[model samples]
Target: MFIKNKRVTLLSYWTSRYLLTLMIGLLIISFISALWIRHTTLENRLEMIEFMAEEMVNRITDVSIPGIPPDERVPNFAEDRFRIRDMNPSMYIINTDGEVISSNLPLEQREQSTFSELINEKEEIRKFTSAKNNKDYYAVKKKIEIDDELVGWVLMVESKDKLTMVKQEYGQLAILIVGLALLGWWAIYFLSRRLAHPIKQVAEAAKQVQSGNYEINLSDHIKEKEVYELVSSFKQMAGRLEQLEKTRTELLAGVTHELKTPVTSISGLLQAVNDGIVTGQEAEEFIRMALVETSKMKTMVGDLLAFNSFAVDAVPVKISQLDIDNFMKDFLAQWYAIQEQTDIVIKIHLLHKEVMISVDLIRLQQIMTNLLTNAEQAISGTGEITISLSEKEQYVSVIVKDSGSGIPPEEQELIFERFFRGENKKYGIRGLGLGLPLSKMMAQSIKGNLHLVESTEKGTSFEVLLRKEG
Candidate 1:
């Protein structure tokens, strides 16, 4: 059974999560704010009703005659005079017997006994639900006193629904909160897409590379530093891989042709001798030629194996402290003795003082021999090969320069790439192009480095850097 995994895109994932969180957070805040506003609005409405009730009490008390009986004392005043500020609560003057004496209530409502039933003598203010109208109302009461004697009470009643007008405002607040949340989500949507765009391009480019297509294009106008770096690095890597792939294809064909040549030569020479086509001395010469071919083949194979082992970190080095001046003298002498071309002149310039450095002799010899051999090969017949040593800071530099036609300007940068042979050497050279790369690897294994300082038409110079003894 095959099961496919679910995947979420960056755009959808980020936007959806942000929207959900924003909506939930805004809803919570709006709910709490709405409740607070509703409570405050109701409290403020009650305070207004209480103030209006007190004012009405004063008006009723001022109009009362001193000797008049409470039932007969109908304080005469204009109905508009009792209205205070914006509050127009229903005002009533009732006796201690709970009978409605004077009121601003509608005639139809006063005909009903609901007002007397809603009054609470023990409380200054009270809330009641009217059975007749099926609505909530608030009744605020204040005592009317004539000469400090409580004669009757003044009541101010207002509908609870009227005081709760914040419901409409709550709707507006909810819309505002949602609008801000949507605006924030819009901003986040673009931001997430902007961030994910470059990364998405890189991912698609990677897929193309995986399919063996190195040619890819990505936007270069990115303003963000880190994203720009990612795109730039990937483009450079793809170009390098393309170059490496081409080199690898060329190397494969070259290796096959090179190995086949020596094998064919050895087979032909041995077959000629074995067929009795040449006798004694001539046959011996044929065998010698075969041995030479075999030796060349053996050397090529050894170099290949050595390079592979070093690449995998299997080759080990033996480090020892050696005097640089003496080591170079012995090394050049032995190299000179093996040269077939006597016209190639060798010169050495050593520092005045002896410099002791820690190095692996065998590895160092391999690096120098490769450089010297390359320099010797570069010179046609007569040319100078200068081996000079210098000390700077805590490092020693060995510079090997040759008076031969230098490496072509175009091929200089790729000298140390594996299997990358220069244009001239690709045709003239007979072995695998691992000399410079292997030499560099060996130099690094011994805690040193080999690099081409400069390679011009005049001459080419290579430098080897080694750490000096403490």
Candidate 2:
């Protein structure tokens, strides 16, 4: 066999066509979720910073130090008094007039324009980045009221840089997406291979059949129902092909032997008479034997021709209502005379006084004659043959039973097949095995059926069903 060029594999094709696209979609979703988390985290951190700054202001104004004078309160309050004051190391305190009150950050980091903007804003807390240093900051400004009169405002500032936190979240999400993609790759490969296995097996089996090898063993270890059915159908076809090959070989051998024997015998008989080896009464007897052989050959040829006609649907049947009881009486009389020397007793049992059925007269007689002949040949000695006629609702049945040795169990089904002669050679059976097949075809051409009703060591019975007259 010539090999073709290789193409893309099923696993890679499915992954590229579907799995990769799905992984990319999931990655996009993960990125968007990470961004949302970063935004929400930043907002929460800013709120926490503002709350801490307000607590510090309340402590400073109340002067929690025991004996600190008013002038020295701003500078003399111990830094150790406030625990939350150290939450933001870059903290700042400014008054309402935009003047710095106290601060941990240097003056260079503070922008006066930003402080002015914060004071004019209606909101209590606002966020902005310093223009000079590019550092992000959140500023919270609160008004200090003493005796129902507004005093100075307290402005608190904290630096807001969340690059490290955002980067950490993004890294975690990237790792998760990567892990899921790896798992998806394995899943896609397994499913794709599973789906493609049956097709591959079928292709391989076809190749073997093309190469004249019909012996194929296919596995039933498949889960998919459709694939299993396909495999089963292929196996059945292969089995049928194998049987056909065997049947053809048998047919060729049988044809060669059947034609050769009769022609050889006739040729020898004629040559002996021509050479004057026998004379008078002996020559006449030899001629008679030759004529009988010739007749047998002619009958075989006629059977073949009839079978060929029926195979192509050329056997025309003219159907009409037949008087079945009267027909069988005449038919059995003819067969009785034909088999008189064989000591076969033929009898008829008519259950109905009169039964009319729709059938082709000539074809019906031919089928019955063939069956009777087979029964006659099967009898090795004295035997009884019974032909029973019965009627059903819409059909009539003719059953032929014989007291001869019954057909073997294994050979019963094949008996009706063309060119199938069972092991009955001991009785000197001379036929091309077309009798039953031709009879069956003739029966079917007139819309009827022939079947073996039962067969045992004692006897064998065959039944024929035909449509009855309306």
User: Top model by TM-score, which number?
Assistant: 1
Candidate 2: misplaced stretches above 4 Å? 1-192, 220-240, 391-393
TM-score of each model, paired residue for residue: 0.72, 0.61
**Which residue segments of model 1 deviate by more than 4 Å?**
1-6, 24-165, 221-225, 392-394
Candidate 2, residues 215-294, lDDT tens digits: the string is: 99888888899989999989888876777677768866877788788999999999999999999999999899999999
lDDT of 2 at 458: 83
